[model samples]
Target: MSVLDQTRVDRPSPRPRRLSWTVSDAAVMIDRGMRHTLRNGDALFMSVFLPIMLLLLFVYVFGGAIDVGTGYINYVVPGIILLCAGFGAATTAVGVTNDMTTGIIDRFRSLPIATWTVVLGHVVASMARNLFATGLVLGIAVAIGFRPTASPLDWVGAIAVVALFILMMTWVSVMFGLIAKTADAASGFTFFILFLPYVSSAFVPTDTMPAALHGFAEHQPITPIIETVRGLLMGTPIGNSWWIALLWCAAILLVVVPISSHLFRSRTRV
Candidate 1:
């Protein structure tokens, strides 16, 4: 045989590139994220613990002075649940930032898997973590006298809203993570998220605030979401707040998801 023919015969075939993501790939990434959560004792503890402490603090320490035309525990529990979910989701920023800055992303790029799955994995893990923390907060709230008058359907609606909010916030955190240069910066970026609930109708009625603050609080994204959850859980008047809350979440996801994708590509580009 000619040398050219021999050279052709000896060459290996090219492997097909993974242009699309698979469920299994996403699941593997999710498992990695969950394992990280399990190994990080301090983060897991604080994610669950801080919300519980805040629940106790607000319910016992501040519940007496705050009047929302209901038992303070009942009035405050929805806010606490959102707070728990927000705090849990915020941790995703730190996790994603760590993965980005630690050279693991480069390792993953060498594999045949879709890189976006890494972010998806973090998002799903954050949702799961936040949901678990939210459940614990609800249980504690009930134990501490948070009584809800909602029917089964209302309970379902409330849960759906909470889940949607978690997902939206998780994406936002992912974007922040992608943008931050360090884990500390990522964590710092989420402080705004953690602070948002306090400014809304979470802790008190927005109307009770001064004119300037009340306008901002009532119009901000968090207030409508808190109002929707409160309405679903407590049988309070929701008005148009439910749909408005949904629209807010949808808008945020629409904006952030594409931005996150772009940032991920830019950051990982060789």
Candidate 2:
């Protein structure tokens, strides 16, 4: 064959580039989220002040009479961390709806950024808020004589589980936000998410309640999470509850994350 023919025949196929995401790109999105949260001052209040207020009210008043084997503060502190996360869910819905309503998602889509960046940004913001609130609640717990016998690794693992549970539920809230026809409806998703814990064993031991109530309470999503957390902090046997909590968190995230992203893209058009 001629040299020219061989050269032409051996010409490389143009590679189809696959999209990539980076730490710097995620950081840019996260910083944008931080700025957005700062601009919305109410988010800080909800994330920090409200949880602190509840901690004060519960520990000083009702906490004195309530008994859950651990110190009252210890008993409720984990739940409060979950509450802080629930509060994050409210912020999630509001942020998503506001972005959609204000055409911010459209603006974002016009850029060369990752499509998943929007969800990642909101999730990071929620994680920041929940982490801050969890730290504050732990401070209060320490002040009220809540101590842990568990090792630092155990505590870290517990915190990681709880934080992830919150993130999973926040994505559920984000899902509602994307498909919500009105901002009011979007905000209401958080209300129900918050209420689920109330009906669970968060405040009282499920076995000590009425038979029917106990049965339902023992099986609820929050029960396993609360039991797992309480076990870690108090050195109680976790039994199967830790695995159960993780499974529930995984199930929720698996169902909600992809579905929420799809709904978000389909509805926002940007």
Candidate 3:
């Protein structure tokens, strides 16, 4: 053998790199999640259509009765947008619960990929699904005289707030799904989320509520989020609401993501 060949043969082989999760793995999970959302016709229809119905109901049936010192349609549209986003994101809990209860997660565990991608895929897919539904609702709102006075920058800000809220709500739904024993139970857990807006400034000003209800509405996380979005979209005064909303989202994400990851690992570990 040549001297160089002998030296190369004597050297130790390099260790194989350990396989870890990658963006492609996450993308595959996301794709799977999106496909699941598409395949569930009833869920897709309700997530989009239910909010539209609520918008119409509030605008026509209740708009004249509620006075917010502005066009009721304009005032109520922001709340409906949040409502639409919340209900759509709440579906993530059902999906996650289904995955947990079914044997599919076990199959996923048998693969070499990180198990957390399953959760992340669901989260991203929910965000995408909710954003689409929100846009549809917003479009319908516009068609029915929901005129927004927002500038281009304000529109961007409003979108950012909505997206942030959706992301936070999706993760919260994931957490609920993780904790629930059954898909139905998981879905039931989201009812409070859907109901939260009604008590917040989403449908009416907080002060209009009785004193006890007003305190709860003014202090809750959803109120700030709705207010920030409303201010941005309608060019209303945002005050400190934008930061408060961002902080609420950041705090929830910070707390929930880790707990979710831990729960995923704990539940999946065999």
Quote each prediction's TM-score.
0.92, 0.86, 0.91
Candidate numbers, best TM-score first, in rank order? 1, 3, 2
lDDT of each: 0.88, 0.78, 0.89
lDDT of 2: 0.78
Q: Residues 60-116, candidate 2: write the lDDT tens digits.
A: 888888887768777777777777777765778878777777767778777666656
- State the RMSD for candidate 2: 8.7
lDDT of 1 by residue, 29-108 (tens): 99998898888775587568989999999989998899888788888889999988888888899999998999899999
| Clashing residue pairs for model 2 | none
lDDT accuracy of residue 255 in candidate 2 = 93
CA shift of 28, model 2, Å: 2.2
lDDT of 3 by residue, 1-270 (tens): 556655435643454323543567888999998998899875587579989999999999999899999999999999999998998888899999999999999898877677788998999889899899999999999999999999999998899899999999999999999999998898796777878999999999999999999999998999999999999899888899989899999999999989988888889984
